[model samples]
Target: MSSELPAFSWPTDPSLQPAIAPVPTERITPEWAWGGSTGLGMKVCIVDSGVDGDHRAIGGMLRGGAVVEETDDGVEVTEGTHSDLFGHGTACAGIIHSIAPDAEIYSARVLGKNLKGYGSTFVAGLQWALDNGMNVINVSMSTSKQDFAGILREVADQAYFSNRIIVAAANNTAVYSYPWLFSSVISVACHAEPDPFTFYYNPDPPVEFTAPGVDVDMAWAGGKRATGTGNSFAAPHIAGIIALILAKHPTLTPFQIKSVMYYTAKNVRTELAAAEEEKRDE
Candidate 1:
């Protein structure tokens, strides 16, 4: 059960540029018309470079134990380490935590020291997330090439069969990136401010949704701010949205959750129609 793939595009839209915004309380605040997401009691696994626990945006949101390892340099690094060296993972974790404040976060530091790593490390993290009972697994990484070894694909299938929801980042490039490229995971694209610029290079169901990513501002190391301009940032929003959805319907299977999200997405057809209209207008 998959949708046909769509063409891709990347445009310079001023309104789409990321700007300074609040700490993503819309997904959590009761005042929101969408209602607050009940991340309480649900545990989310954030598989990324790591998190800086002390960041104001993430303060008490950080939960779960650390998975640490020593780098070739002999430096010790911890999972949910609660500190960011490059700030990329922190920004991503902030988005997920902001939307699912009640949801406990389990950090899996697959990427270490600025996110330079091999595919095996990420695969290991994915397996770890499953074994530890992580209801939601957020993978904000991409592999340029698409290769499916028997065991890796089986692992993805096992997670799906076991009812674990995995969210992945669509590759920044026009080409598909794995595990987002893999049909088992939810692939997310970037949608930025004002004009709401969207980047959907892949047309398959894998590239299901889009969220704020462009010049979006988020917490960085040393109390600084960083702006990202890619789908990488957008993926967390989808992960966060999933957290909200799962909180409401705990019994939903991965397939059912994915279907409901697509069916209930705010103005999805309208947005796609509008995109086509704009293309015609151009």
Candidate 2:
């Protein structure tokens, strides 16, 4: 007797067409278990000071992006200028690239040209990201304007429904900021972790995630690098991780991605355990 079993084959019929079955979304699990995905083919918009694509830390590559400008009439969108006005944008870009090296980074300059014309420029940059079909947007800057908060909330929600993940940095101080404080966007703050990839999830409101932001060595403009600390650096770490997740699992919705970030965080279990302990004591 043969030890091997014969495989079953489908019957061939000239009169019948082959039917393909579609897999259900809920039943599918992403391949993030294996852990080898770059942000290749993903468009990540850095809506801050522009990025210098030639920076060594960025690997001398970037997707061509638009620069928002303010004129006497109104905000205008222009192309062919992706140079970082200040070094802040470059620093953020370097962190994102360090994690998702192949992600298609784009610059949407909205700040630091003079900081005087930020309102319109900020709106224009975000609008550009939405209009251009960005997969992920990293917003390291936020406005404290309460009057514009409602509109910004709507904008963030629109991106959420569109599957465009926006990772925003919480305000360093106790003062409020738009977009980041909104429930739709992922809000990140600082932690003491020295590893660039290390991140934690907070159970608190407003600040949902904490990544390495204390005295981090980052890339700056003019092909230079520096050590800095703030919630600004923390936002990009989550953004980069998101880029990796989106690369491996492009089908994941914004909600699903947020869940992944929360559950896979290094400190989630610890945080939950501590909360449970406190509740038991109470």
Candidate 3:
């Protein structure tokens, strides 16, 4: 006997339309965005060399992680706890942890001990993060290869539509890079500022934000600490802040979160001065 499949149908007229709750404030401020948020329930994935769970800076906040390896059958992602091949991933994790200590951090180690890896491996790691229900993905490294551009764009678009935010770092040099160049991701670069919480949103295209990256102290592998500077470090600062926002407003989509960031950005806050004044008058 043949069995009938369940019917799949769209909502009828009486069905309520999908909608997000309106933000209570007319003007988005830092206080309104993530003032007291501790990033309690957010899941952040760092796609990099790897993350050292034992690092002091991590503070035992790592939930789990995966390692992407190259085998005869192509790329393989093994899920479990992993160590940072290089210190890059640990540094990124430290930044995010410092900003959002309560958020769960997971690592997708794609790079090798040399701090480099194949583009295909990077893609696989990113795909792993997307499939594993990561709320935010920190991509401090990017591939400049033209062959991977199409796939990277596709993945970035998927993250955008899936309510998963990908905070990418722009290349430190003048060279080009994938994913970060896409509008679907939040691209960040290094600023000379020392304050981690002080970030600026650029009005230009591609690079949308700037965060502290110069001489920033970070958690290194082997239970040590180090200072470094690069766009790589900058991306996690934004990623951490994004975690805070997601923690407070769990229902918000990626685009809505970006709008909130734009409004609360250090540079953009001046434009909201008039709005704040108007609100005070009421």
In terms of lDDT, the best-performing candidate is 3
TM-score of 3: 0.90
Q: Single out the weakest 10-residue window by summed lDDT for candidate 1.
A: 25-34
| Model 3 RMSD vs true structure | 4.8
Q: Which runs of model 1 end up more than 4 angstroms from their true locations?
A: 1-34, 68-82, 145-149, 194-206, 269-282
Q: Rank the candidates by TM-score, best first.
A: 3, 2, 1
Q: List residue ranges in candidate 2 displaced over 4 A.
A: 1-34, 114-117, 269-282
Cα lDDT tens digits, model 1, 1-282, are 644435554335757655433333223222231256557667787777777777787766777645545457543434444555567777887877777778777777767676776666667777878888988888888666445345556777888999988888878887755777667878788765523222233344658777778887777666677876887888877777778778876777898766656544555545656886999998
Cα error, residue 87 of model 1, in Å, equals 1.6
* Worst 10 contiguous positions by lDDT, candidate 2: 25-34
Task: Pick the TM-score winner.
Answer: 3
Residue-level lDDT tens digits of model 3 in 38-141: 99999999999999998889889999989999989999989999889889999999999999999999999999999989989999999999999999999999
Candidate 2 global CA lDDT score:
0.83
lDDT value, candidate 3, whole model: 0.92
Comparing 2 and 3 by lDDT, which wins? 3
Candidate 3, residue 79: lDDT: 95
lDDT order of candidates, best first?
Answer: 3, 2, 1
